[model samples]
Target: EKKDKKDKKEKKRSREENGAAPKCADEKPAKETRVEGAQAAGDVAARKAFLKEHRMTMEGNGVETFFPCYTFAEAKFPAQANEAIQNYAKPTPIQAVSWPVIRAGRDIIGVAETGSGKTMGFALPSLPHILGAKQKLPKVVVLAPTRELAMQTSVEYERLKVNQVCLYGGAPKGDQIKALRTNPDVVIATPGRLIDLCDSGLCDLSQVSYAVLDEADRMLDTGFEEPVRKILGMVNKKRQMLMFTATWPDSVERLASSFLRDPIKLTVGSTELTANVRVKQTVEMIQQYDKDKRLLALLKEYKVGDNSRVIIFVLYKKDAPKVEGLLKGRGYTVGALHGDSSQAMREATIAQFRKGEIPIMVATDVAARGLDIDDIEHVINYSMPLTIEDYIHRIGRTARAGKTGTAHSFFMHPADKNLGWHTAKVLRDAGQPVPPELEKYGPPAVKQVEKTCNISEMAPAPKITFDDSDSD
Candidate 1:
């Protein structure tokens, strides 16, 4: 008995030196563990109180486990955290609240406007979960709605030295299959291609412990809900799930209930279709034919510079190339991105835009949701989006990382009148001026003019006889 006790003591000391969990028999006493847990609870309470004092509203069960961090220095792995902070300066509001919740190993639903640093909000917390794990299978799977977003998410993981594979359509699958053979630690992919890989036995999700649904709303909008649901079902049910979106529609709410287990919901601001407050919004009422000229004038005001990078969004895919040509002809370096653009072209365009080789990018809604580029000073809506949600996302391309930006929207009368009411409401909520034509469509006003004239008010005219003179 004496010899066994001595051996156990030495074993516990060795494990401590090696940074391993202590053996059950040598673990701390239950009462001591409980006391430490109580202290942690108290610390979280204090942090929540601080958030409340700052007017950051958060609500849900088990939210006390989440504590906001003012800087990356407060992170669990400060070295890794500092890498991101060095680029972003500090955490945004969403990142500040989300990091702790995700780090606490609880499911979370994060809703914030575009350009709020949501990518890092989920990425930072996932690092610790995946870093030391065996690379036989993916431990983290991030599903994005578009290829651009998936690629961007993968880049975030790469910056941290985390091994990752991005799988999406439009690109050749042979490379992706070869990447999967290496058994990466993370898989960033679109829903359709992920499902195809899983079905073909080229990938596995049974061991996936962390799953993130980025741009959840857009996923549903693009008819990816079925594939997303299927992928979720294949993953470990005991895993931690994180759902992030710019807007929370009924579809996304349903998705959360089905996949997430007792999620804590966090919203950075009012739960409505709203753009970042830092974006100065302007709505110009112009004729349809004059939109190109108006866009030229706006672009002239914001030339290529360190702080003058811009994204111009068109409503249709066909318009993207046309706009690109028009801008290039006007002596502006520009690139186009849309659904029809080949994967190689899209990648080259995005790379050029990121490096400021092309200071302006003309794109469709494909670039609206998850393309994260820094220092975008302006977002020009050459054509109004079909929905107010899309409009908010389009303008969100600017005003990112707490930096101020400008959004200029061309609202052609008659053509864009259908969206006038919703557009006016969004502008009003943001405290921006509503064009007179759009203001007429606002609440408490008539959206359409009723051209009515009563026949009873018409005056009678006397009949006159004319002489037949020059007919012959």
Candidate 2:
């Protein structure tokens, strides 16, 4: 017993010493600097200090409990990957962890929350393996919960300019099928359209050997389980599997155990804590009638300038276009994205945000999944998201690519008090500050939600500045 106890202690120490979490960068199409610490929703100065210290440590030591720099060559990636890495400083945390596993052709269940670099973590490693020399038969297949997540990952794959195809609902998939004829090594797609393609015999995922579930938790929460299971049936069971989420809920774990084999279970900060830390969180108790007024006041007070980009997330998709109209009427150059939006427009809005043409963005949960633009300084929770997972992905839009960002949520009705308090608790547990207003509100009883269809509308777009390198 004594020997066993000693061994256990040593093992625990080793795990703590080595079990650093994964991190990732923003899909900043622009030449923006990487974001470091999270936005300080409460203690801006302290968070800034933490970021500065963390940056110094990372720069000096070249490793972090959450993020560590890694080379593409070390990841066994193709030569072109080195150029992409050279363009950026270092691989974010997610890239460091997920890169090795995906590259090794192993199944993974990645449980870090957003802004932990989860997107790039999987993206960088997977692309090279799939886009390999000669007769790679759509070896990689990506499944996302929302159109936004699917499109964003597709955009990043395009930025990498790897031969890939993106398929999702909202637009005619003829173009996607045409791209597939290019014999793309990677396919980034939503569960819905992928299923349709599988059923119609337009694409063959039977040759697929690697798969990823981005924002896995949200996929389950947003009712994508059935579609995911059907899609899974289409792929090769022997393929490497990677499942990532902001947090590891029970459902997420069950799915991992079923899909991943002898898999490495990676848990970063708890889901609630991951996004809350970097967010400059704040809340002003107000009357229900005063909600909009209070939001405008907070925006005016914080005042994200023309230079910075912002995303405002709300519970209902109906509110996304409403708020977009409201802010646009107020003379803020704003646009909207949601489930109801066509795939084409969703891509257009994201492109607009990336090119710095539209600095302000308002949306429902569509923006929450994996919209990966960088330098998003503010994430305004116009109202509480439907669940904690939604909140995690929502605010994670900011403080990405190793840059600092702020996230603010407003609390109005007493019934809605738990939303703010829970968000605060998640922050406090992560060693982040919980403002006094959190305690002032106290715990809350749950309020019922209105039954609305999941699909929401997205805004149309002007032309964007980004381009791609097609293989000739």
Candidate 3:
């Protein structure tokens, strides 16, 4: 009995030293007491200092348990950490705060501005969890709102040497199915195609350990709320959830309550609708007919060098082709991207644009959310978007990675008057100059009404007498 007791104690001590919980019933209480005492004293101070240093706002239960990092070396994945240090040089604000929370195995709702390195914020932390997992089904599933974004995410995963299969609607299903047969570590997909594949038994989420909803607000806006819910239901219940959005609306909060289990809300900046301060926004009040001329002029002014890139955003997908054609006719090398473009054509266009072979791209809102190309010089809003949220995303195409860029918007009077209030608010928030005409349409301005006197109550006969005499 003495030898058995000594062996048990030695086993418990070994487990404790290895960072594992003590399994012996007698040693468990002491282990818990020590852990609680240490946590009560050190954890709070460390978390407070980290939050203040990073200028981050965190709200949720047990948020103090996670640590923040100044460099990727302190993160979980050393390989990805090395890659980030060597390639990207340093972590962005979002990455610096989010990587630690995510790596600590906590569900997080990350709210950051566009072009704030949100992809790497979620991607790097996710790698260490799913990289070496052995399972027939994918361990990590990243849902994007658009095919382009899904493909872009897949590229990021590949860069980290994390084998991933992209399943989006525009691509060929046979290729995706073949890729899935190999059992990739990560599955980057859009909601519709992912749902279709899961229903058809080509893809399975039963073994998914990590689920990410990238651009969560945009997903809700694009009518993916139901599909997202359905996909979430199909995944394993005991999975880690990460949601990222540029802006947080009530809908996102509702989705979080429904799907997430006590998630930590990490907002890097103001949650209100605002554009990046790095973007220099200008509004040109012009007639609808003169938009073409203004676009050409702005292009010449902005797109000066061979490496300079410009993206012109239009409201409708049909307008993308027309704008591309018009620019081509004007001796500009340009390409168009919209939902209607074939997958091959869209990929080719983006590749050429990225390589600087085609310096201009005409696109709809499909390219607004998750298209991350560095060094884009200008974003031209040839036409105003339907919503202020979309307008913020449209201009966000440029001014990425700490580089200053310009956004030129052509606003038509009376037609764009309804958007005037919201547009002016965003402009003022970004510290840009709001046009005087547009400001008139903003709030705090009351219209003057002409008050009429009651003609029946007035002495009208005296005034009519001269007219009657002239008529007679």
TM-score of each: 0.82, 0.74, 0.83
TM-score winner among the candidates? 3
Candidate 3 least-lDDT 10 residues: 460-469
| lDDT of candidate 3 at residue 312, scale 0 to 100 | 92
Off by over 4 Å in 2: 1-70, 131-136, 271-273, 418-421, 431-437, 440-472
Which one wins by TM-score: 1 or 2? 1
Q: What are the RMSDs of all candidates, in order?
A: 17.4, 15.9, 15.8
Residues 1-472, candidate 3: write the lDDT tens digits. Answer: 9999999889879989999875755453453322111233456555555555544577765555555565555554656546544767667877776776676577888887778888888888777667567676788999999888898888888778877899989777999999989888899999999999999998889888889989888776538878998998898899999989888865456545667776778876566788888899999999988988888888887754467899999999989988989988988988898989888999999999888889999999889986889879999999898888889888988988878899999998777777899899888988999999887874646566444332222222221111112332
Off by over 4 Å in 3: 1-55, 442-472
Q: How do the residues 175-259 of candidate 2 rate in per-residue lDDT, one tens digit apiece? A: 8889878888888888888888878888888877778888777666548878887777888878777887777665455554555
**Total backbone collisions, model 2:** 25
Ranking by TM-score: 3, 1, 2
